[model samples]
Structure formats: structure tokens, C-alpha cells
Target: MDKIQHRTIFVNGINMHVAEAGAGPAVLFLHGFPELWYSWRHQMLALSSRGYRAIAPDLRGYGDTDAPPSSASYSAVHIVGDLVALLDALGLDRIFLVGHDWGAVIAWYLCLLRPDRIRALVNMSVVFHPRNPSRKPLESLRAAFGHDYYICRFQEPGEAEEEFARAGTARIIAKFLTSRRPGPLCVPKEVGFGGSPHTQIVLPSWLSEEDINYYATKFDQKGFTGGLNYYRAIDLTWELTAPWTGMQIKVPVKFIVGDEDLTYTTPGIKEYIHGGGFKRNVPFLQELVVMEGVGHFLNQEKPEETSAHIYDFIQRF
Candidate 1:
């Protein structure tokens, strides 16, 4: 293991633990759910070797960061604001942003809310599925998917938090990190995309023995409350995003997803991506690339390819 120096910084009234290495152009790496700054271990070293200040942080409430107790504190607005304050704290004016899963959600919001502070954007495994202001309630979405939808289960207060807590973080992490081999070319009917429930499944290939333990240890320390707060804010997210309902991200944007990823296969998915909100909001968008034979955890599954695509995109600007 290459030893990397770690530090603690205060942002948005919370103490954030960040792992940093290399030095050059700024590339802020943000991890998704149940993951820590360690999620970008490879990318941080790779980019650092190539003259980039690669920084990854355990976003508020996930790792060493302070986990606020209220769901209201976890809004996308607040998350993005934290990122802004992070930059301010570091005295950085602009940066190349990279995020996955829930981190991608915050990345999208950050780019929208403060484009001037971001030099470029790269998202993996998650798409910019804007909040549907008039879409059916999360309950209706859950009822539609049933046991197949884990997200809807998450939306219900206390139920998911309690269930995941009882099951333990290791179980929850295993469920999402399932295998990537394209099996049957089918999307489970129960897990709807864009804030729908996810069917329980086995862990994916990307997670090795050490990876699992790493995540489990963090969950052991943080519990799932802070991470769950992101999901709990669905309704609040909708209400907050109402102001930017028609706002498209004008920054140079790129969305990457695995072909085997359940996200791209949801019914009416393409319409959602290419029509209405997306088209109107992202004016200077880049292409969406789908990697075959890969699952949702692309960075871990295929680091060389992920890094290549990201560097290529950043070089263009």
C-alpha cells in the first residue's frame, strides 16, 4: 500500500476527513454510498503521478465527517454548498470534479449551483436523473416495484434505517456490489431506475475480500444514518430543486454507465435522458458512454479505462 497523508478540514460546519496525495491541477474525487475517500485510492495515485492534486473526502456523515442528525441538513443544496465551502477553505477557484453514485448526485447539483467553481465534470455509474417535480410519490414508485425496489424501501422513515442497521452495513454493501457479467440482458422488474426500489442481489465482482472489509469497517464506525440521509431527502430534494426545475448544466459534462448497469435499462429511461429536463438543462453536454461487460462499480472494475476516459475528457477543456 502506498502511504498517503490524510488530514481533517472543517466545511459547512462539519469536520470532513480527506485523503490527499499528488500535486498539480485540482481533481476532486467524491465517492458514493457506503464508500469513503478510499474508494478513489487508485485514481488518486494515478492522477497524482501525472501532476494533479487528487483529493477524495468522506462526505459529511459517511466516514470521519460529522453526521448531522436531521434529514433537512442532507439536502443536495447543502451538499453542494459544502463542496463550495471546501474549495473556499482550500483557496481553490476551480477544479475537475469526479463522483459516483450519491456523490454523482451531489456533483450534478454542484455543477448546476456553482458552475464557475468547477473546471469540468465526470460521473460514473450514476446519471443526472433530475427530480421529477410531478412524478408519482415515492410510495407509489415503491408499490410499483415491491420487494424489487430497495430505494423506495429506503424512502420510508425508520424502516430502511432499522432494517439496514439490523442487517448490518456489510449486508447492505454486499447487496449493491453485485457481479458485473451481463446475465440474461434483463433488468429486474422490481427495481425501477431514477429513485425506484432496488431488488436485493449478491455482491459484484469489483469488491474483493479487502474491499468488503474496508467498507464494513467504515460502516462499523459511521453506521448508516448519515448515508441514508441522502435517500431520505427525496421529497425535500424535489421541493428544493423546483427552483432549478428547468435548469440544465452548462458545464462540460460526461456521464458513464456500465451496459449491465440497471440504471440505463429502466423503462422510459432514454426518454428521460434525452428529452425534456435533461436536454433543456445540460447545454454543453458530452457523450454518454456505456462500457460493456461491466457493472455499476466501474472505477474499481476498470480503473485504466475509467481513468483514460476521464483524462481524455479533461484534456479537451
Candidate 2:
């Protein structure tokens, strides 16, 4: 961890903070909501030791990166643009992409918009959701999961931020990182994200107090608005991505997910993943591994296995 280097570079009109290690083929890691480059600490060290350059950014609106004020600034196009410019600035023409949660969602768009810049991809948690020509993303999600669903709950700016503030940054970080529940996360307006002041959250063995503090300190400074903006722009992203409605992900890919991941259990998701729908859309998908009993935070909870899964599939190309 001490060996990893950090730097700030101007990209896509924002000063972006990036953490990097090793010096071989670049493997770009993108993190999910409420996460930072630190989320990939173990994988960065593991991959770096194996002679692969590991790069994880704080992303446009998270950590040390500049957070543009408007929700419109966080669309997939904007995030992907930041990455393309980062690659150009670093003199990297192509990279091995790895993403989890929202990061996986961005990786899918990266492959969709600029296949030439990616050598291959290793994605976790979220799967590629093909565009729906008939409806917007939030609408579909609200209809399927109801208004209390987390994504729906995140649509309104300042609403979730207030709940997060009331919950305390450290407690919120602990709740997300240590969560092992497989059901859809729904925070009702009345119940709030704080979930009763009396409810106690126990940290898992994989997550330490230091880790919680690291994330808490950042969120305390930056607030949750920037991270939540990604959700806010979902409908706009859907509007802008119409051209990619039925297109297949063209890069060689390997996907892994915890059997207990909420994404894995989402209605119709199992069918999409195994009912030939996923394969049909991702024709170049090379492998799929389901780790039993694992949860959404697979990279952090199962670092060694996650790193091995990444190294094994990426080394083949």
C-alpha cells in the first residue's frame, strides 16, 4: 500500500486524482458509488506484484477529483470522456479494464463507446443492461423495484444527502461496506437511510475501523451529492445512449459476481445472466464465475480470489 503512488492530472476539464502502481500492461480499475480508489487497494497491490500496472482513479466527482456542480455533468458520456482523456494524457492507447458496481456500469459503456481503447474487461457485480428504447432508466427501475428502491430514492438531489448527513458519514460507510444482505436496498422516505438511530451496525472482519474512517473522512469533506449525481443523470444518459440500444459488447470479457449480490438476485437478472440473454448481448464474454456466499463488495471481501480471477482471465489475452 505504501508503494502505490498518487498524482493529480487535468482530464476532461477537471483535475482528477489517480493512484497507480507497477509498470507493465495497464489495468484500469473503476470503483462504485460511495467508493474511492482505496477500494481497490488489495487488487492494486496484488496486480502490481504480478507485473501489471494498476490504475484506479478517484473518479470525477469522488475523493480528490473535482466535482462539477450539475447533475448533468455526471452522465456516462462525461465520465467516459474523462477516462479517454486520462488515457491520452498518460500515453496509454489501450488498457485492461476492471470495474465493480457503478464502475462495471461505466466499463460497459466504455466498451460500447470506445472499444478501440480497451484490450479486455473483467467486470463484477453489475451486468451490462442493454438500452430500452421505450422507457427511461429511472422509470423502468421505479416500475420494477418501486419508489422506495435505492436508485429511485437517489433520483432527487439533496434528499439522500440529508439522510446521509443525519446518519453520520462513518456509520453510512460502515453500513454500505459491511452489508451482506442480498435483497434490494430500499430506504423509505419515512424510515430514512439512517434506519432508526438505535439500529447498530457491526463491521465485518474484512472491514476495519481504519478503513471506515478513511472513507468517512472523505465523504465528510466532499458530501454525498457528487456520488449521487451519477444516479441523477440516469435518465439523461438513457436519452443520450439511444444509438447503442441493441449493440453487443465487442471486447473479450470475463464477469464475476457473488451469489448473494443484490444485483445477481434482481428480478429477471438471473435469467438475463443465464437464460442466454446475457451471452447473446455479450457475444465475446469469455467467462462467468459465481462465488458462493459472497456479497456485492466481492473485491474487498475476497481480495485474493478476485485478484486471481482478474489475473487468470487477463493474462490469456
Candidate 3:
């Protein structure tokens, strides 16, 4: 971990914190919610050792990066702008792009908006669905799942933050990191988000207490509001992305998802992936891997396999 180099680069009006390792072809990593560049530690070291420059940024509103006060500022355009600016600042024209969860979401948008900037893509956890002209994303989610569904639950500002406060930062981090449930995460008002103290979350073989503490300490300082703001701005992304409606992701791509991930088990996702719709949208999609028993945090839970998949795919380009 000490081998990793840290630096801050000014990008798109925010000072972005970036962790880098190695010194060859650059591989940019984008992390999901409740996570930072630290989540990519293993992959960074592995890729760096293999003679590639691995760069992971904390992104706006997380870790050492600046968190703008408004959810409106957390829109996809803003995040993608930050990344593009970061790439330009680093003096890179094209490079391998890797993303997990929300990072995956932005990666797709990056590919859509600026394919010339990406050599290839290996995206995990989240699949890119083009903008729906007729309906907003949050509306679809609310209709399919319910008001209590996690994303919908996150729509209300400060409510979930209060729950995380009650649950305690470390405990909530442990719970989210250790969770294996493969369905829509719902938190009703009566039920709330806090878990019992007796219900200890056993860390998986891949995650250590030190890892959780590192994440916990950061979240302890930065708070989850910056992360939650990503969810809070979903509908705005939907509205702002109308110009991109029906546009396909036109980059060589490999997508992987854990079978037990709620995203994988979500109502229509299996059919979407297997049913050629995903391919029809992402015409250059070269591969798809569904690992059995894996959950949402596939990159963290199976760092070696995830890194190998990324290395194998991006190396081909």
C-alpha cells in the first residue's frame, strides 16, 4: 500500500485526489459509491507490477477530493467532465478504463460522450442502459421496486445519513461491504437502516478489518452525503442525458457481474444481458462474465479475478 503514490490534480473546478502506481500504459480506475481510490489498491499494485500505470481517483465528493454542497453538482456531466479533465491534465490521449458500480455508470457515459479518449473498457457491477426519452430513471426504479427501495430511499436528503449515523459509520461500512443479499435493498421508514449491535458483519476472506477501518475513517471524515448525492441526482442525469437517447456505447468492452449482485438479480437484468439487448446497445461488447456466488462489490471481493479480467481484456486493445 505504501508503494502507491498519491497526488492531487486540479480538474473541472475541483481538486481530485489520485493514487498511481507503475510506469507503462495507463489504466484508469473508477470506483463505486461508499468507496474511494483505496478500493482499487490491490488492482493498482498488481497492474503496476505488471508494467502498467494504474490510476485511481477519489473523485469529487469522496475521500480527499472536494465535495460540492449540492446534489445538482454531482450530475453525470460534472463527474465525466472531471474525468476527461483529469485525463487531459495527465497528458493522456487514450487509455484503458475500468469502473465498478457508479464508476461503471460514468465510464459508460465517458465512452458515449468521448470514445476517442478510451482504448477499451472493462466495467463491473453496473450495465449501461441508454437514456429513456419517455420516463426518468428514478421513476422507473420506483415503479419497478417501491418507494422503500434503496435508491428511492436515498432520494430523500439527510434521511439515510441520519440512519447511517445511528448505525455508526464503521458498522454501516461493515454491513454494506459484507452484505450478500441479492435483491432490492429496501429501508422502510418504520424499519430504518440501522442494524442491531449484536448482528456483527463477518468480514469476507477478501476484506480485512484494516480495509474497513481505512474506508470507515475516510467516510468518518467526509461523510456519506457526497456519495449519496450520486443517487440523489439520478433523475437529473435522466433529464440531462436526453440528448444521448438511443446512442449506443461504441467501445470494445468486457462486462462482468456477480450472480448474487442485486443488479444481476434485478427484474429484467438477466434478460437484458442474455437477451441480446445489452449487446444491441453496446455493439462492441466483446465479453460477459457472471461469477457464481459473487455480490455487488465484485472488484473488492475478487480482486485477483477482477484484475485479471481487466488485464486480459484491456491488454487485447
The numbered model that scores best in lDDT is 2
Residue-wise C-alpha lDDT for candidate 3, range 1-317, written one tens digit per residue: 88899999999999999999999999999999889999999899989988899999998899999999899999998999999999999999998999998999999999999999999999998998989898888888889888999999898789899999988998888888777776778768776665676676788889899998999999999999999999999888888888888999999999999999988987889999999999999999999999998999988889899889888887776
Model 3 TM-score, 2 decimals: 0.98
Instruction: Report the C-alpha lDDT of model 2 over 49-126, residue by residue, as the tens digit.
Output: 999999999988899999999999999999999999999999999999999999999999999999999999999999
Candidate 2: list runs displaced more than 4 Å.
none
Runs off by more than 4 Å, candidate 1 = 1-3, 135-148, 179-205, 274-280
What does the lDDT read for residue 190 in candidate 3?
77
Candidate 2 global TM-score: 0.99
TM-score of every candidate relative to the true structure? 0.86, 0.99, 0.98
Clashes of 1: 11
The residue pairs found clashing in candidate 3 are: none
Q: What would the per-residue lDDT of candidate 1 be over residues 1-317, giving only the tens digit for each residue? A: 36567888999899888888888788998898768888888888888877788889899878888899888899888888788888899889999999998888889899888989988899876667655666634655565656445565566566666666655566667655664433222224343221122445545455676787888888888788788888788667778778887677878888788877666655565566666545556666777778887777788788878888888888666
| Model 2: lDDT to the true structure | 0.93
Sort by TM-score, best first.
2, 3, 1
